[model samples]
Target: MKRRFTVSVILSRCSLASSWIFYSEYFYNYQNEGRVEWVYGDGFAHNLNNVNNLVSSLRFVGDEDNWKMDSITLFEFDLFFGIEYYDWTDNTQVPSGMSTVGSLIITGQNYWTVYTSTNFSGNRACLQVQSGQYVGFAADLDEYGIFTVRSYRRGCFGDKKITLNSDQHGFAVKARE
Candidate 1:
């Protein structure tokens, strides 16, 4: 039997312009990170039904040219195999005048949700999944105070285990198969 796993991210209270830029930068950075590939919208949609080890990154890159600020929410989802893996990070800091409130990671049987707030101070939160649950972990923030979450599977392949970081800027989670 094949199992599907999905990961999603949602950002609340951000301007459309910023959202676009943020997402663009996110995809750019993800490609730079070299851990995953940039799968466009069509590629993502087409692969959702298959059980494979795939990583999809979606960002709400806000419009930087517009001086106007608009509250925005960003959400993304990924689906793969139960024993598959996916990971991401928002290394870039919000624009100077922008604020990030908070972030949340909700893990389910076949899907996970990550939510980020607009207020800068409030946007510093991380969620890690271990044994099919969100494991509160530590995070390490850069000079810009951008929060990130890193997760992977450990143990003997099928008997994998998860480890999570217990910090505000960075988080890690391990899961066992």
Candidate 2:
């Protein structure tokens, strides 16, 4: 892990009301290490057993300085199927002892607030995705790197048909239209 993952977000237009960035890769840590920790990288929580801890969340509360009332969305993914890695830089990350994700989390907030488990009956892992991205299931976790998803959680966004996947079996929450 000699490479440094220096991530800095520069909003083309500083407006937080209707804009967001998807979580695909892990952001730099407080120590500014180039290593990847599984807190909230690749739109999924870091390795559940040992994840890249999430320090704080930044929300766009309809203003430039949203610290007053900014709300953060905390999403978690239980990796019971297997450990996976999501690389959005070029979508071609060859990890050592890691499997490729069939789907990716584009962007959104409050995703886990709707979905929780892979299926209603099973609790193999807890599911968490972005609110704005439409996600479905990944047929083969070891094959495709990214794929389009469909909604699985009920009562999400009130069937608003908003745009957003994986067994790699997990649940998803579709955002509002």
Candidate topping lDDT: 2
lDDT of each: 0.24, 0.25
Candidate 1 regions exceeding 4 Å error are 1-22, 26-28, 33-133, 136-163, 166-177
Give the range where candidate 1 is weakest over 10 consecutive residues by summed lDDT. Answer: 77-86
The digit string of per-residue lDDT tens for model 2 on 1-177 reads 322222233431111222222221243221222222112222232122212233222221111232112122211222112233332121111333432223333222333212222222211122333343323232232233222121123223332232334111122222222
TM-score of each: 0.18, 0.20
Model 1 TM-score relative to the real fold: 0.18
Candidate 1's residue-wise lDDT over 29-136, tens digit each? 322221211121111222221112322333322122321121122212111111111123222233332232222222221222222332222333222334432222
Q: Kindly report the root-mean-square deviation of model 2 from the true structure over all alpha carbons.
A: 15.6
